[model samples]
Target: MMGGRGEGVGCVGGVGGRRVGVRGLGGVFEDKCKEGENEPYRGALAPALALALAPALANTHHHNIIKLSLQGNVGHLVQQHAICHGNLDYKLEDGQGPVLMTTVAMPVFSTKNETRNRGILLGVVGTDVPVSELLKTIPKYKLGIHGYAFAITNNGYILTHPDLRPLYGDGKKRRKPNYSSVDLSEVEWEDKDDTLRNAMVNRKTGTFSMEVKKSVDKGKRVLVLHNDYYYTDIKGTPFSLGVALSRGHGKFFFRGNVTVEEGLHDLEHPDVALADEWTYCNTDEHPEHRYLSQIEAIKLYLSGHEPHLQCDKELIQEVLFDAVVTAPLEAYWTSLVLNKSENSDKGVEIAYLGTRTGLSRINLFVVPDELTNQDFLTAEDKEGVFNADHFPLWYKRAAEQVPGTFVYSLPFNTGSENKSVVLASTAIQLLDERKSPIAAAVGIQMKLEFFQKKFWTASRQCAALDGKCSISCDDENINCYLIDNNGFVLVAEDYTLTGKFFGEAEGAVMSKLLQMGSFKRVTLYDYQALCWVFSESSDSGHTLLDPYFAFFSAVKWILTELVIFLVEFNLYSWWYSDLTAKGYNKGKRRKRMRKEDG
Candidate 1:
């Protein structure tokens, strides 16, 4: 008969074939003999029997060498096993000499029975892996010599790192170290703030930057290098993976590492250098493929920079010839403005033009020296330069216009002067080159108040012509407004209504004005009756009408009338029903009295 094993450890020894049957009760076994021959086999328990008793003896609190080891109740060999909550443990020994391995344990259970839905707690079954074998599975960097990957456990322990030894011990004795005892920061020296270790322990995924000192020029010099790290947890496990890269050698290295080629590059070529600086807003910074910010681009433009029109030799020559021809036109424009507006104080504040030489644009800005010295512009704008690309709306409108024909922009406020101005644009088409169709344009920024004054003077002239058509600039009875073709108010007595759509100002009269296309005068009798409300501001003679308020007022009136009608209808129905019931009751009473008298 085989004996009991020691400490639930398996015994590995060849045994002769024999049919053995034994009865056991309270940790004692009895074997029956045949014909007065009785002896107990006290060597070691069979491997199968030892495995069967493992689950029962796993949690027992007893020191029975008979139940532990079967060699005459004397326990010799002991097995060392670790048990911790939510932790993967390594074993020192498992009955078969020192194995030095880790295990993944799964709870083994008996099949379900009639009394219980789930099986009984039999024991734990575990799969063992040698530490040496597990070392081979640890990952390594596949690309870039400077970058490396590492792994750590949930308890801030180092599972794998570049500097950490994967397999521990000398060749004679294979030993596994307690990996959970080693902290990750012990190997990662660059983790000065301990951020990486904390993030890994907390199971967080993010990136951080750190600095490391490294030997340079074969240990002749040492330099501090910036490093970036990205870390995340390994799913289905308690470990995390961390990847690190040297900051200067990773992605976006081209931002500073690349050198300019020594050739006629667009930004480097003599003809295109000025143009490139002027049109830098359109050019993307290499590697990133993004243009400079508007604030930065505008600053570069206003510093007297000019574009070379993409180094087009023909286009450059044409623009140069045009500039020569238009040089005197600037003086002529200035003279005409001074000659015409000498009697009146108001005139053009600034006159600038953007010429489309090729695909790019160049601004030929002309602001009088006296006006430029004023605090009309913001501090930054006054300090920096201007680019035609910065004001695309003003430039593109003129560039796309028909040649020599003028188009006007809605009046907009300009500068610290608090004066409103309108932009008048006219395109200048090329005459000599039919193949290269270039459309240059000029813009004259005139004060909006100047136009208001002109209209006011015309009204006075009309009053002088006819007695019935008398009107004043501040007349409350008359409201004057000039609208664009799209019915957006451009000029109004109230400057606040300048940029508003016509429909928003007068919804009731909007259809009438839209239908009367180019008619000079069309009067509506009792015009105030069409509108519900007007602004109460007394400074402006003709206040802006609020159509939204009128629409809501009309809706409120309709709802009030509907509620009154419903209430009156309900009251009339009740009154009619009560009167009919009273008449029927009076008739019944008269018939009862006649029956009683009869």
Candidate 2:
């Protein structure tokens, strides 16, 4: 939880002055000011206490702050101001030993033309934002019911996580680690491959899934569940935001019978109104939302075993009925459909009504245009005729499921251009007056690129409130995907691989990738190999050893060489002495022999 000081923004004055002042719309630090008995400071009440400013603060540069403020669309202040930012740190209060905070300062610099304080440092306006406040809203935003959010720094250190324990030292020495030292890998026990950690630290935006084991019934039983993760780096900051969802709890799709017991409470609301009460929908207002019955829908509803509708009017009416009934979904559709990509031409390419008869049916589909051209769809008043063969094959597969269940389709081609697309459909069982079931389903189709971008942008949006920073997800190293149970690529940054087997693209077994298992092994192997190669090389800069170890190694080599040289020199001296003695003896013996012969 954030302290009161962090809830609202404030300004701190007098960085280089003898006294500092704090002010804000919320009257920040007003109580402390009132308690002071000293003379008034900054033309207001004096602060309760005076503290010494650090000498290092005098030489700080603030150019990044200006750039961030501009990107964040920050409004101008009444007065001119300069900017400065600080790293995460701990501030010890009178009673509190230490509290972590991030300080950002906006300074008022002396003008170049000023006569008295020309080009000199002036007072600074800063705020102490507790780290808790910086990340307070993260947990509230989740991927699904069992989803959660976590953050990490550029170095892979955990910033905020559900399982994080900030305190480390024991007893009187107990204190928070320097700016969250815990690594993300510590709590993500199932992440064996280090894929999530590496990708996030490297500032890539993507999604992936893993399996997690949980104990239930007081550890009597264990359950293996799939966990999905979406992550992206915050722009202009050293942090990344991630959201994880449990497979069972997240409503990726609905399965089994759609019952009244399963709440559609929003639909029951009186405020839930239709686009057009008389006609199911008006193509003029929402042309993309209303499509003429696809040949697939007509075949299923009109020519199927039950033969529910006899004529084209009946089929068209069914389309209108489905469209009007699904009005509650407009808000969601609008957000997704209207969202355009960085490339203006690309967006949610297609949104259509795919109706079929039975107790279970897929009612609507929002997809990218197969032709990859969204503008062509509305350029002319085209006839409402769909190619008889163009209905998605996945639609039929989805229609086979019981109402209230969700279905995910493999990648397929649409339109003559053969662009690949994926669909996710949810089935709804509509009830008649006597409680008989009529089928209804809502589905969406997205281009691989559009789908990937949508989720990546979602992760980057986490830094929206921090006006001084922006998020970037366009790194070439970015590789993330939405995968299914069997490791099939669903949505991926690499759009070409959409709908392919994950193993096929990655060339690894599913078990190896279970929890980034293979990735971890690869990283370890690379590390060891590099260590071995660099160990044999003579490059001191690239050597793994620290300066201390290098110094000791040099000393050891010199000593070894000195010992060998001394032993060799001693042996040579001994050999020369022995040879000289032998030569003198031989000469004396030859002289004695010559005298005896004379």
The Cα local distance difference test for each model comes to: 0.41, 0.43
Candidate 2 lDDT, tens digit per residue, 1-598? Answer: 1221111111001122112222222222211001121133221000111110011111122233454445443424302333233344567777645666655555545444553335355555555656544432221211212445666665566656645544432324245433345577765756889999988776566677798653221121233557777665443334556766554333322223232222233233332322111222123223442453333233333334433333334334444444345554556545544554433544344444333321112122234334443432131211111111111233333433445565665433222333555556654444322222324445655555566567777756657766533434555665566665434566666666666656566754554665564322110101001111234556456544588878988999999999999999999998887554333588888999999999
Question: Where does model 1 exceed 4 Å of error?
Answer: 1-310, 334-344, 358-391, 399-404, 411-418, 430-438, 459-476, 515-598
In the range 150-199, model 1's lDDT, one tens digit per residue, is 65655665654544432332322343343434567655555768988988
The CA lDDT at 70 in model 1 is 34
How many Å off is the CA of 105 in candidate 2?
Answer: 5.2
lDDT of 1: 0.41
Candidate 2 residue runs with Cα over 4 Å from true position: 1-86, 91-98, 104-126, 139-145, 169-173, 176-179, 213-225, 252-598
